[model samples]
Target: MAADKPTAEAVAEQLARLREDYQARLPAELAALTALAAGFGGAESDRARLDELHHRLHKLAGSGGTFGFTALSARTRTLEQQSKQWLAGSLDEVEAQAWQSLAAEVAALGETLNKVSPPQAPAILSARDSLTSDETVQIWLVEDDASLAEQLRRQLESFGYTVRHFMQIGDAEAAAHTQRPDMLIMDILFPQQGENATEVLALRPILRALGCPLLFMSSCDDFESRARVARLGAAGYFLKPLDVPRLVNRMTQILDQLRAPPQRVLIVDDDVALAAHYRLVLLAAGMEAEALHEPQAIIETVAAFRPELVLMDLHMPNYSGPELAGVIRQHERWASLPIVYLSAETDLDQQIEAMGRGADDFLTKPISDAQLVAAVRARVDRARQLDAQITRDSLTGLLKHASIKEALEITVTQARRHGKPVTVAMLDIDHFKSVNDTYGHAAGDVVISSVAMLLRQCLRMSDIIGRYGGEEFVAVLPECAGGDAQMLMEDIRRRFAAIAFSYSGQAFSCTLSAGLASTAQYPEFSGAELLVVADEALYAAKRGGRNQIRTASPHPLQEADRP
Candidate 1:
């Protein structure tokens, strides 16, 4: 009979059970398989024993495959095939070595099977459920009736509306206050256990203060009730047992009406009235606009507001807009912050000077609303795309190495300034060279990839891991003390040592050693100094034992303390 199929976790548990259940049989099984593969060349009786061994492996394969122990099943199948060739007298010495290797592989695969936990199910099941596009709308639903609420929730989810449901009006209000949800849907006849409708009417003041569009749902069919709701600033009213299709269509229409292009404009003019007029024009177009009278605050304000584009007047009190553009360009952070001049001085030489000073494009003082909107949107979109590429790692889907390093350095500096602790760890795989030598380079690549995944799994999301070089990784742990760092390193060491790699019908295992250094006691030390200390401790670990962790001494080692 086939063994029952097991989940990944169950498979691991079964391996552990097997280790204990067949403890005495394991060594004998290994010995038999090894002897069968090695082939007792001159003995006829031993050849018969090999045939029996081949049958034993075949049974193991059939049972293991049914039980979801795939690695074991696969290894056994390969061994079974090789054993048949041996019985037919067609297998060579090199092929014999390959079969003998499978015994060791099965042992290692069993060890790995014993270590792994099951993979997690995805948090979200559908692409539409995940917020991938800016065009997708989010709606907040506040309803108390369980059945009706569930009906609406399912319909909205199916329609790709990111919906958040709340049972209590108070809870809904709290959420909206904190997150500023795009739209709100509330029930007017909110159930009252003991309190009267008058007390519920008091909630209208609080709701009005939210400033977002509100839609009310009720069963009341009177004109007086509809007028009252309109007074409460509700955009629309809907009846109970809602026409869900019509409601959804209306909601989509409402969102589309509200979906004006993001309006964020910077006005850099000394003339307050003219800047205010431009601000009025931009605001009328549904844009957020800021007017800056002081040319000196250009860089600071730009950094803070991140205005989509700047509109500057060429002639200013203290500095010309063209000169201010030149100053803003000098700041590396704001170098790409788009600037456009709104100058009355439209002389060809003046426009040339403005463009030369890094103004992306020039517009005369009498700029139309359409031209202004198009120019700003184009520049802002380009800037966002560039920022996304700059921050991402092309290879591993983690932060780019350079960006993470810069962030770590800033964190280290902040920790130093704030009198907090920081720890850095350097991890290296033990005897990685041997893996490449025994297996092909492709197998070596697998080992490296597996190690990278293991490191990512072991560390906290807050902790940063970067590929330091080939076969080495670095992690920066903010606010971690020396003792905590040691504990974390040990956990990583144990987890990494547990991973096994399978290739070419052979299974291999590897371990990692780490060195940790903290800047708690050594407050004056730089990030580079912390790295040096960690690297030295790593070398010490290699010298003492390959799979262990060594922490840097609090104080420098004396001459006699050196190895």
Candidate 2:
């Protein structure tokens, strides 16, 4: 209880500040609403002003209850409904007495703003730790082979992983009681059988207690051995004569899948205070939230922020939520983007009408912080899943060709704007057709996916890799120089060549060649131009040798044929 006092006090102070801020701005907002109401004529030409007035009242109704002004919120909501009705009605239908009554109610809005106690703190305001990306990945390696264990420890450490080597399962279990690693790798067999030499069944409890992904490695490639590991829910299985790079690649993939990027949400509302409140709530719940006050900037902001879900206010001065949603849907790329209306509108018919205009759903105003976070998270998660299915390659799970090219162009433009260098690599598996001809298409897929995993494991997480088409792939490395990128590709090419592929009891290996083109070398080239140059260099690499890397020559002067 004592430990929670500081957090509670902090939340109280923040709520107090918000209440004060809302109170200070209330007089001006109320005055503006009153002026709009007084000047309303209910004529065709006065439609814009009526819309503005309605929007202001809508905001007041929504935010007033949020700050504990329940009475004020209710009054404004009735006025908002009246204004909406006027907008829907013709000049003949709107009577003079009705206009006067609405104006009077609007003018008396200030009287409803009498001081009230601030609302109680929301659950979202409780203190929570932030996740940092720089934390080292902890890996526990439990193997009876001391030499292999030390070698693996060294290799993982070189890749910036913290490795703990335990020669016995009992030793590893003892360490797990004190601290758990992010992932665990262990062997299935122990020659020195004893109480410490726990069998597969005995290891289940330790694995459950650690609560992390497990990767099993063994020399035996028998179906029984693999099936036994499968039942334990191991993240991966690696055969002996282990390729360390491939092992690290599997580890990277598992960690990446476990720690997904935070969900992105865009909050669009005319009420600055209310938008800020929602942003704070989402942020506390470990989401990335941004607010857009100017409705006209919706398209531009959405493009830059690339939010998974949009939380939009139902009414605004210039554009209603439905109109803006229509604008977003006009672009084919954003057609499926989620647009949820958050407003004080309680009419079922009106809500359904708004949804028909392009919104996916509607949430009533005065929503609690917890409800807002949960709703946003759920929507964003589903949006991400749908997006991945649409844009990613079916086999490699990387961006498809068209999507990757679009991403590269955007990355290049951003890098150029920041005056940073960007590099693009064109990679192709050497003798890929021969492998398919000799082995089979299924074997070809295994080789392709292996290269994809290697690329994902070897490249910096910030780099983007995609399967271009067939045996070819593309990688975009932001802020990487040509020489550095070439060196990286060379390392990957060698490691890939060392990987053995088995087909029908025959062991075969494949190699890859890569071409590099950097902004440092061709400063004036666009992403498309860079790709053309990289393709040229890729052919050059093949000409030089089947398994090597080549950098593009400088752009030709006055390239009349360049696309």
Candidate 3:
């Protein structure tokens, strides 16, 4: 028989089962330990008994967190340490300390264990799922009123959402069992006037555990009602009657958050095995990860990987982790990149010292797999979200208007310093207003999104592209003249014109006109000046004929200097 390996999901399921078994069996174990402690004698005869009790505490300390009961595990570790001192002939310490302290600690741990909920399998996001950005968002609505449900469904559908309505919580729960929506919109009021659905949901916590972003609307908008929704971790709560447009806008924002690309992580550890292990763990969890075993390659790897977070190992042969973090921070571009130290150093003072040198956080090694994933994911997600707010366009995935301009200015300054050419293209979709007038604004949006997708597909990784407001795109191409940029724009124009868009069963196509200005044509022009020149050429292209590329002429001085 071939050797079989368990899938990650299977491993997580097994771990969950093991964790549940551990939680269920904990109270009995704690009671037994207390029973043994109560009858303890400080004599040789009690050695084995004390050892056994100490052993049990040790096992709980090590295994509790591994099985997901980190609090219980930590408490057990403290008890185990106290017990160890007694078992190793320092029995007076335990006897000196009020026996009540140990008893109280054990009781407190038991209480925590008793309150532990059922173990849930760790959520795993696959590589394909993470890479498939902009997955169509699905929304499930739980509203008993059919008219309101239908109205919201139509409104959401118009915004390209797949909306499902559930008249009863049971139906929604059943649908969730089959297919979980990306988000949920629910009403706290049902047919029963006084029965708030939020209260009912609190009783049945399954919906909350499914982990979709939640939004709730309620006629009762009191503090108590808001507090109840807050406990459920709702993304938004609206007062009824709900504002459809505002709700749709909130839903879109949530969807954008969900559809953002997986965070990229760079692991810098001298131990190749450990780094590779971390990489696999992150990649299997639907993150982009690269590992660097050599400290010398840190800067290069970070530059190429463009990581949202860096996992640094404290001790390395070539340099210290904190020193490396400080080095990375010296580079202005990477100043804010999240750098977390991952090492076996457990001394709080030392960890704090490392963090003082520019590290964001310090996580001791031997952390549980789940804890590691959660830690890194939380950091990377926050870092990326913060970055997106500054660097990304809200409507399209292209660079934000100001960000692209900043990027272009930087590129232009570099080109000037190096005496290299760079091209800036200004593009506008031909007759875009007519598309909105003819079909609808929704159709116009589709056309704009389609063109954005095409540009992303065709642009070089080094090239910079941005959405300069509605139906206008600007792209920066390094080391290319206006002629070359125009050629590239012509190809984009052709490809975009070929994309067939449909609204209400009526198919149509759209095209774009472009203008290109190059540093070669006007060597002294700044990035902003180049943009103005490009925009002028774009208008000329539009006036000459729609759906064409126009290149700006070289400066008269530059033409004479060219010889």
Candidate of highest lDDT: 2
Q: What total of clashing residue pairs does each candidate reach?
A: 2, 0, 0
TM value for model 2 = 0.58
Instruction: Give the per-residue lDDT of model 1 (tens digit) for 261-350.
Output: 354678988889888988877755545577989877877777765676787888887898788888888888778777877766446788
Off by over 4 Å in 1: 1-296, 303-321, 330-353, 361-394, 397-410, 431-465, 493-511, 521-524, 544-548, 555-563
- Per-residue lDDT of model 2, residues 220-309, tens digit only: 888887777777778888987776556766786788766565677899998999999999898667666779999889889888777789
Predicted structure 1: lDDT: 0.66
Model 3 — TM-score against the truth?
0.46
Using TM-score as the yardstick, the better of models 1 and 3 is 3
Q: Which one wins by lDDT: 2 or 3?
A: 2
Of the candidates shown, which would achieve the greatest TM-score relative to the real structure?
Answer: 2
State in Å the error of residue 102, model 1: 55
TM-score-better candidate, 2 vs 3:
2
The models' CA-based lDDT, in order, is: 0.66, 0.78, 0.75
